[model samples]
Target: MTSILIADDHGIVREGLKRLLEAESDFEVCAEAADGREVLEQVERTHPDVVVLDVTMPRLGGLETLEHLRAAHPDVKVVLLSVHGEPPVVQSAAALGVHGYVLKNGCATEVVSAVRAVTEGGSYFSPSVARQLVEQLRAPRAEIPDPLGALSGREREVLKLIAEGLSAKEIGQQLSISAKTVEAHRTSLMRKLGVRKATELVRVAVRYGVIEV
Candidate 1:
């Protein structure tokens, strides 16, 4: 049987996917995780053949988790399920060597097909996602300005916390940095995002998918 690990923050979504994948005759639901940290932990413990991971989660996020997975378990296959089908997002996942890219809104059967294809040394993408990749390839290689590309990793953390309504002091405590340093990050974020007000920073964060609505 093909062992699989499912990772998503929503219990209902995980359960639904678990049931759907288990119905496949050659598939086995080996494990489940609620967040990216748990995903790494479960992957280490279960050593699943394939990982069905959601792009957004409480900690570490899908793309970040995929980075760690690639370094630690390069042989394992990852099939990302995301709400975003934008060219930048799909291109980012592809650049990271993701085996499959399936939209959350796509047909459920697509998920099954993705897993099967990847296991057989092929790749898969949702029809819309495939079209986006094709269009990107057909277009000139001019650099598409990524909104989040300007921010450093620390700035991204500060942006997320700010969007979540955390004060500078609170964010500093969580990141183990001084409140003054956090303030500096906030200033840099506003500058890079081209916003003057703190409220504008939150809007920019949302626009860049630094935080969900």
Candidate 2:
């Protein structure tokens, strides 16, 4: 049997995935986790053959978790699940040695196929994701500016939160920083992006595909 671990912050998502995977005779839902910490704990306890991991979660993010898993549990295959199909995010996951990349909107069969392919020492990318990658590769290289590249990691985080409509206080609370620090990051983001207003900042983020619309 191919023992599987499902890691997603949403309880409903976990339950649905467990049910779907368990329905397959060769696949077993060995464990489920609500976040990255629980995912590591479950991996230690259950040692599942594959893990279906969500890219965004409450605690440690999926890419960071994947890095840890690659270093500590290289034997296990991982299929990243995400809502964002942005090239940068997908490329980062691919560079991290992810075995599969499946979008959240993909059909159940895609997820199953991803798991099966990864466990069999192959790789899979959702159809849309594959197309996007190919399109990027085929597009002519241009000296297009990268606004995100100028921002620090923390600045990027603040920008994403701001784009999501989170206030400085809320972003600080979520990131464990003070509101003042959040404000500082927000100001720095605006300066770096050369945006005079918050709305303009969000527009730049959306244009660069930093945050989904």
Model 2 residue runs over 4 Å out of place are 140-213
Across 110-183, the per-residue lDDT of candidate 2 in tens digits comes to: 89999999988999999998887677677774643345556655676677678888888999998899999998
lDDT of 1 by residue, 1-213 (tens): 999999989999999998999999999999999988899999999999999988876656677777679889999999999887766557767877899999989899999999999999999999998988887788777756456656555676677788889998999898799999999999888888788898998877666555678
| Best model number under TM-score | 1
Q: Rate residue 36 of model 2 by lDDT.
A: 79
The per-model lDDT (C-alpha) reads 0.85, 0.82
The true-versus-predicted C-alpha distance at residue 176 of model 2, in Å, is: 8.6
Q: TM-score for each prediction?
A: 0.86, 0.71
Record all residue pairs in model 2 with backbone atoms less than 3 Å apart, i.e. clashing.
Answer: none
lDDT of 1: 0.85
C-alpha lDDT (0 to 100) for residue 136 of candidate 2: 64
